[model samples]
Target: MGASKVIHAIYTDDDVLMSAVKKIKAEKHHIEEVFTPFPVHGLDKAMGLAPTRLAITAFIYGTIGLIVSIVMMNFIMIEDWPQDIGGKPSFSFIENMPAFVPIMFELTIFFAAHLMVITFYLRSRIWPFKDAENPDPRTTDDHFLMEIPIYNNNQLELENLLKETGAVEINIVEKDEAH
Candidate 1:
């Protein structure tokens, strides 16, 4: 199988990296990926990435959890166990609401937390015991990495562009299967 070709550029500063990205975009170059040591403010906007809907999804999921908790608690407590164990009234939903508050709150929290985590995991394509693809280890430290996939085999032109954008170092990555 033919390995995919990828160009890697290392940057020391986020500002410089952003500037480089802007320049590259102006020249109509395709930016495959960008790796940074820390989250850069407004980077997503600069890269034209859509705003994340995780918060909205989480709210909807949490609301579902809360409603399910309330309904389940009311059905179990009022219908199944109508006995007033502690002299508490259980004939009316309003009266039994106070007694069910603890379970309702617990279930709401449980569902919200668990569902949010699962949503995040699924959305981010991450899971337990799965090895992640980290393009550059230096991105976890202080270095920034910008990967631009050349579509027309124009390394010389790309090298000039990287040089003009103040790229500290540029390298080519070749992959081979070990096993």
Candidate 2:
């Protein structure tokens, strides 16, 4: 079987990378990824990525936390073990809600943070102790790397196009299908 190939276009500046991305999209080429040393503003829009729905997941998680705290506090302080919380004579959970505000707030933050992390890991197909898939280490430091799949015999033409887009280094590499 013929090995798959890819082109790595490295840029020294984010501006150059952004423009190159636009050009690549205009030509109807698929971009696998763009690695950057830091956050590049508006780069996601340039790449035509859909807006993330993580905020919606966080809201759901926060709501779950709120419900759990309410049920647990009501059961523990009222039903299971009635106590003189906040020096209040009435032991009803409804009347003692003021004392539980801090607990509710804390649990809401805690659940949202933990669930969001797990959701991110699941969505990204990442887990603890997984091997790194970065094609180049320089992309972690100062270089921005753009990856484009090579189909048929377009390596030279893509290389020329990358160079025109201010790419500092262009490399054609064989990619393994099975890792």
Candidate 3:
């Protein structure tokens, strides 16, 4: 494949970045990616990306954690070694469930939070010791970057549009096609 040309538009403020994104989308140009120092609200909607399913995964993880906690507590308190504590004999899981509520809640949150993070990392292809993908490092500090790939000899048009959309700095770079 031929090397593709990409335009990197830098913005100082998120508001300007947001407006630029909106204008770019209005012009029907496909945005490759957007990098920001912090999360920008409604950027995803403006980019026309689909809604994330992380909440559903978190709920599933929490349910699995709850089940594990219940089973562990039941085995330890009722089946493994039944002991009389607080003047009550540990026999039935239902009867002893109240004392296990705290553990259950904690385990549920732990699983949901940890597993969600792992899921996000895996889904985003982020790993320890991985190379950074942002073309400009300033996007991590105090700038926002919008990447738009040029196709069919539209570099001049895109550059003009980006300049009109309040891009502080615009750069055209040749990016090797990733296999």
Candidate 4:
């Protein structure tokens, strides 16, 4: 297939970008992506994107960490090598559960935080030494950019709509079909 045409709308303010996105969606245009310097509130919902499942993964990781800490503590303190301190014998995990609570909590947090970051990076297709996919470098500073793919020869209509919605600059770029 030939290269696809995409409209890049640059905005100086996030409010204008949000309004443009809503207007484009109202007109049934497909937005390929949006780049922003900082996280915008409610932008994902406005883009019609689904909620993320990162929290669920974090909970599962935390549970696994908690279970690991419990098993390790049980084997070390109760089964493998038991010690008596302050006239109390470490023969039962339940009897000494209080001392293990801190370790369990720490491990849970550690696993949740570290695994959550790794999962986010993997899911986003980000890796060390990878080239950036950002279309405009200004987006990393203060500008916001919205990318909409042209379909059915509606580029003129989309350009007019973008201008009406307060896009400071509109650019038509030929996107490589390979991507």
Q: The CA-based lDDT of model 1 is what?
A: 0.82
Candidates in order have lDDT scores of 0.82, 0.89, 0.93, 0.93
If both were scored by lDDT, which would come out higher, candidate 1 or candidate 3?
3
| Two-way TM-score contest, 3 vs 4, winner | 4
Better of 1 and 2 by lDDT: 2
Model 2, runs deviating above 4 Å:
1-3
Best by TM-score: 4
Instruction: Enumerate residue pairs that collide in model 3.
Output: none
Worst 10 residues of 2 by lDDT: 83-92
Better of 1 and 2 by TM-score: 2
Per-residue C-alpha lDDT of model 3 across residues 65-128, encoded as one tens digit per residue: 9999999999989999999997999979999888999999999999999999999999999999
TM-score of each: 0.84, 0.92, 0.95, 0.96
Error of 1 at 29 (Å): 1.7
Tens-digit lDDT track of model 4 for 70-110: 99999999999999988889989999999889999999999
lDDT of 1 at 128: 86
Worst 10 residues of 4 by lDDT: 1-10
